[model samples]
Target chain A: MFLGVLFSGGKDSVFACRRAMETDSVVCLITVISENPDSYMFHTPNVRWAHLIAEAIGVPQLLWSTRGEEEAELSDLRDAVAAAKKSYGIEGVVTGAIESVYQAARVQRICRELDLWCYNPLWQIDQVEYLRLLVEEGFEVIVTGVFAYPLDESWVGAKIDDRLIRELESLQKRYGINPSGEGGELETFVLDGPILKKRIEILRASKTYENYRGRLTIEEARLVDK
Target chain B: MILIVDLCHKAESLSKYEFVDPIASIVRRTGSEFKVRHFSELTAKEIERSDGIVLCGTPLKDDLRARRIELFIWIRDFDRPLLAICAGMQVVAAVFGGEIVPQPKIGLERIEILKETDLLGPPGEIEGYHLHNFGVTLPSGFDLVAGRAGQIEAFKHSGRPIYGIIFHPEVRNKWIVERFLDLG
Candidate 1:
């Protein structure tokens, strides 16, 4: 079956695209770029680079813009999925939702309304283990955002590896933070992975952090040969 | 050992990691051994060898498995402890003379336990994750353990250890599955 992945240039969505490719044809990547930094549903940090990620993965992308209102973004999502179905002939939509009922349920409802099957390949996954899996699966992910206490500015712009995962695991035990950033505590961007035909090289990036709320903005990046 | 039956649309489906593996993770965390088998690939030998059976849930859109109820007839004779979740609940109820009705639900909701049982403990209110497109009516010779008569959140056979719940326990109430494994 041909499928379209809800892409965000994050580790979860990129890994979900790989998982989808394992079982079905990932025909396109559906990207919803929200203007709101505090968007309720979609991820915001460096999502503009989703086109690069899509190009790296060698999949076509359908980029849709949204005002990022509370409920309006859902309609934009629906429109994006509808467009994917119409243009790419996608029979199903896949999401990277792990434990967020708020995000997963809305996507499920939209897919249902459009008469398309929705699959959450990472539903209810163990966060720490998932982070480890992402690393073990050869995904080079950089922490792009950090929200919540106990996670300082150093977390922003750090590469996710064994040391980072161990620190996150320790924080999970000490502070109850989701290691994979399920609670909006952190955000990630994938640079290289087993599913990517090309790797993304960050040329220049800027970080703005204050009081544990920070983001690493990729001002420039280019795809390099893996 | 607990045998987790995958009731997804097919074997090795995209839904397996979503629906089946989470339950398997819970069982593993509870320190119980388990083996997962697709409903279409299950065998009596494997079923008889297991101490208990857990029927895992499927995606909301994968109701195609429900129409193939003939594959679930083995559930009627297996007397060992069993627990059904969501799509599994529908199958168990259908095999036991219950009707499947369109009762779609998604996301977290408050579930009121109607009666005390070994699986769910005492009657009270608890939030559970629900992601099902259909709900099953109370089957014959089964007692409602939660929810009202028309909307059955949970049920168990009057005489057997067979149980069913409409919510996905892997979301928040994994102890229910742990308790079922402890029943062995």
Candidate 2:
């Protein structure tokens, strides 16, 4: 059956789709962009890069943007999901929900209202192992946002390498940071992965550290033809 | 010490405001130690040993089938100093005689304290962050500790030491955390 994958370009969503591909055909990647800087609903500040991930996965991507701070965005997401079902004729939707019941429940509600099957492949996987698998699979991931102590701007451009994993482990041991970067300690974006048909090369980038936070701004990025 | 129960199935994706930073700040301010244990990881011994419990917000909303809900039920019996945030608040209410219903879709609304209890003292209106669609209405025995804009914003168990606030006090104000710590 054809499926619509809720693609956030994060490791979890990508990994969820990869596992689902083993059993079903994923037809579209859906994402929601919230205008609010501090959105209680959708993933913020890092959603701009979702397009790159959609391109890498070589699937038709749909991004729904909303001015709704948090809950209002749910209406936007519902509208997008409905449109996707009508246009794509997909029978099921897949989510990369690792832990947030708030998100999973909302998605489930939408799916139930639409009469679509909701698939969550990484529903209960261990956070540490999930990060390990992302690295093991050679997904070039980088921290794009930081909001917790012990994780700051220095981590913005840091790669998800063995060294980073070790640092995360140490942080968990020392400062209660989750090794999976759950608890909003950090957020990431994938630059390259197994599903990518082309490589993304960062041509121009600027790193800024201010307001007790750090960010790596991609001034220029391009998809290199394979 | 505070024990944060990780009810989230995907704990990694939650924001720092929801769990990590608030707990860390509370620990630092109170000079108290804290540990995070997932619901699945906890043993009966661990539950009994907890002095003060903080139920961290889960990505999952009110899912009756969620295994974490069962764990919450087990913890409810312990009757230790308890605090539940967004999803945690909903779970606590559900465990008690309260019900969780969808809230109006609003962001950063003003929550007026209707009455005073030890939880939010002096009974004055304060602005608080709201991110949940569900609200709690306690049963007969539970005393209404606080209210905001006509809804029951916070409550205390009549028969137990249990307390809950619908708004995220830890994320909004330090006094809330301080008060919870004081209870312990």
User: Mind giving the per-residue lDDT tens digits that candidate 2 earns over A158-198?
Assistant: 88988888889888889998776656667677788888877
Q: Which stretches of candidate 2 lie over 4 Å from their true place?
A: B1-184
Per-residue lDDT of B15-113 in model 2, one digit per residue for the tens?
A: 322344445556665788887776567777777887888776543232431334566668457677887776777778777656777664323557667
TM-scores, all candidates, are 0.98, 0.55
Q: Tell me the native contact fraction for each prediction.
A: 0.77, 0.00
lDDT of 1 by residue, A1-226 (tens): 8999999999999999999999999999999999998999889989998899899888999999999999999999999999999999999999999988899989989988898989999998898889899999899999999998998988899999999999999999999999999999999999999989899999999999998899999999999998
List each candidate's DockQ score: 0.82, 0.03
Model 2 Cα RMSD, 1 decimal: 8.8
Looking at model 1, the pairs that clash are: none
Q: Write model 1 residue lDDT over B1-184, tens digit each, in one string.
A: 7899999888999989999999999988878889999988998899989999999998777887678999889889989999999999999999999999999888899999989999999999999988888999998899999988777899999999999999989888888888998887
- The chain B TM-scores of all candidates, as shown, are 0.98, 0.83
Off by over 4 Å in 1: none
